[model samples]
Target: MLTRRTTHTTLALAASLSLAGALAGCAAEAEDSAATPPQPTTDASSSGAGDGSTDTLAGDAGTEYSDGTYTAEGSYQSPAGQENITLEVTLAGGTVTEVSLTSDATNPSSKQYQGQFISALEGAVVGKNLDEISIDKLAGSSLTSIGFTEALDSIKSEARA
Candidate 1:
């Protein structure tokens, strides 16, 4: 048997408590969002929106590579035969410090051109930003350069922060 004033006070207290609980739940959610970094998405072209949409690749995020050796494989047909290319690159401070390539070409000419191509390609790619590596020419190894470029693409995808 509560009095009128007592009943009103109880109802007001219950309403205030419910509102506080709702606010506390919302605060927890806000903290969670603030604690987690947005994950980079596979689609490099999108602007990573805040609505949980796919984010841009890490290269565009202005983040450095986590400092490691990254490797990628690429294969393509050359004038001599099918060539499998393996690119092992060392990155530091987000720069390609070393580029090592091992190419297996079925064609005799490919074997002949491997060393020369490796030397030339290393000069072009080393000291370049990992994202902007484009092997446009390698003297006499045009077909092998194509394969190398493919490997570069793979490496970029792998090395994304």
Candidate 2:
């Protein structure tokens, strides 16, 4: 009678352990199913200017427009002095191929300083996209640089219209 009772208890313990192991396996699978899938990465190349068109003084490149010249005028006043500037832009195939600057400075001191500023402008912006062009101020000619950029911006705005 005692041997039969001990065998029954051992059988019950083995059954309980099997059940616990099965429950643990099911719990792990449930946790895995609850997890989220990885998301795809975003593309950075398509971020801005969706049309893929480049900005130029004439219009977008490869377009046809009148051959006549367009003129834009602007002025800048700073602590140094006032600068009056005009830009003559030539357009071909709807692109700005050339830019010319005319400046009026009566003061000798202003003229000397403005010359360096104008030279910097001519080098930085000629043959470049008007929309993308930006000016970094020269070390000692910050005011003149501001004036030059203002004039260039006016030219860009007029050309876009």
Each candidate structure's TM-score, on Cα atoms with residue i matched to residue i, is 0.60, 0.48
Error of 1 at 85 (Å): 1.3
Q: Model 1 lDDT vs. the true structure?
A: 0.76
Output candidate 1 Cα RMSD.
Answer: 17.4
Scanning candidate 1 in windows of ten residues, the lowest lDDT window is 55-64
lDDT per residue for candidate 2 within 1-161, as digits (tens), equals 56988999999999999999999999998888779566645455555766664333233333334544677666677545777767676755444577676778777766776677666665565666555456667535566656566665555555554
Worst 10 residues of 2 by lDDT: 54-63
User: By TM-score, who's the top model here?
Assistant: 1
Query: Candidate 1, residues 1-161: lDDT per residue as tens digits?
Result: 99999999999999999999999999999999999978844654455574555654444636456567988888777666677889899988778899899976656777777768887877788888776766656867677777787887777677666
Candidate 2: RMSD over Cα atoms?
16.5
RMSD of each: 17.4, 16.5
Error at 119, model 2, angstroms: 2.6
